[model samples]
Target: MDRQAPRAGFTDVDRESDPRFYIRCLDAQHASAFKQRYKRRTFDLLELRPGQRVLDVGCGTGQDALALAAAVAPDGRVVGLDFSRTMIDEARGRSRGKALPVAFVRGDVHHLAFADDAFDRCRADRTFQHLPEPRQALAEMVRVTAPGGIVLIVEPDHESRLFDSPYPDVSRRFFAFRNSSLRQPGVAHQLYALFKEFGLTEVAVEPLTEIATEYASIAHVAQFEGGMRIAQRYGVVTEEEADAWLAHLAEADRTGRFFHAFTYFITTGRKPA
Candidate 1:
């Protein structure tokens, strides 16, 4: 397969054809039960302590940051950082009228604004897949964490996406194009190796598969319709073929045989105490 130039959504929300659409998609994802489970688990994995500073990279709308703030209460601070002003604005708005020890900042992940060992713990959820420099980003995540601090991240492996279809070629071409659309869709598969190479101690990784028997449930977060449009626009697949695949999925849903899932990794490692 030839490598196409990245047209991944979420790399730069300002450049997205419809940034509002992306924002809404995020809001929907946050509301989903499956996502909520992972979000809770991430918070638990951090083992957050009161009055310990935390940083949430790529904190869309500040949901996780706000939650973390409550966990690290009294004097602890949670800084939610994202590159998009639009997102920062939304996050600030969402955090308004709250006395939570949280703040939102607009910044790049490759070069974090904080000094070394600035945070007791750091987390980035569903963030690495959109990074153009994932290794550098992970390094930055580690650099800012204090000794004995935890660094946890969760990212999807786009290559692992599955669609049950009789036309294997259709599934192959469409998903390949979809995978190529991300800046680093395969980052999840590389996290374990990167954690070890980066010298993160006590490294542990867990896998989670999000499966949806209903098309809408999966499509809500995957944005498969927009992806199909992009696939058609890029000549990866024809509009008719895309439509047929959609119909196939819908039929499968009706027959109670629909299946679409993708695997993501939850990885955690600690800085040496």
Candidate 2:
């Protein structure tokens, strides 16, 4: 069977105008749990101090940015930047009533609207996979960060995804479809080398792995329906096969046998002073 080209899901539309699609994916309860699990780890790596300026590129909905704002409170500032105006608006709306010193802006990562060495710290989470020119974005991140500032890049290695489905072939097809949909599905593995290439010092890469045993969490991670839809659309799997695959998962969830796992690379580097 020939695998079909993966259809663009959230990446297909202009997120600036259609932020709902992206918001829906990240607003799920399981998605929050997944984020909480890693946010602390990422923050610890940042070593943020009071009164330092921080920038969160591709700050979707401002969750991390809000957290950073709280960490840098009393005098510090945190700015959340995204290319999608609607996303920025949603982020700002979420910030209402909060006295956090965080600002949301619509801007491109490749051309940050900030002066060189303007921020004490910079980070982008799960953003590079969707970017066609992730290297350029990383360069901009390096450029805007002040000397000795930390730059953290956290991204998932989609090729490392694993699922315990009854139909291994269908699962394989689904994985294939999922990986093909990403702009740089394997960018996480390249973070270390990219940091070195950008002349960053004290580069470190940490792999954060997560396993989802419950249906809700697994569904959020696998994007089960979306993956099957893409597989069916591309002829990677028959509609019947896709249905059967989902049924197997549903049965596993009911039987307390559901399993899914993936790894994300959290790479951090310090800009040379």
Highest-scoring model, TM-score: 1
Q: Tens digit of lDDT per residue, candidate 1, span 146-235?
A: 999999999878888888888679888878877776788788889999999989999998888888888878766666677777777778
Cα-based lDDT for every prediction: 0.88, 0.85
- Candidate 2: worst-modelled 10 consecutive residues by lDDT: 7-16
lDDT of candidate 1 at residue 159, scale 0 to 100: 88
TM-scores, in order shown? 0.93, 0.91
Query: On residues 5-114, what C-alpha lDDT tens digit does candidate 2 reach at each position?
Result: 65454343353445587777666632566668787899999998999999998888888899999999979999999877767888999999999999999888989989
Q: What C-alpha RMSD separates each model from the true structure?
A: 2.1, 2.3
Candidate 1: the clashing residue pairs are: 8-181
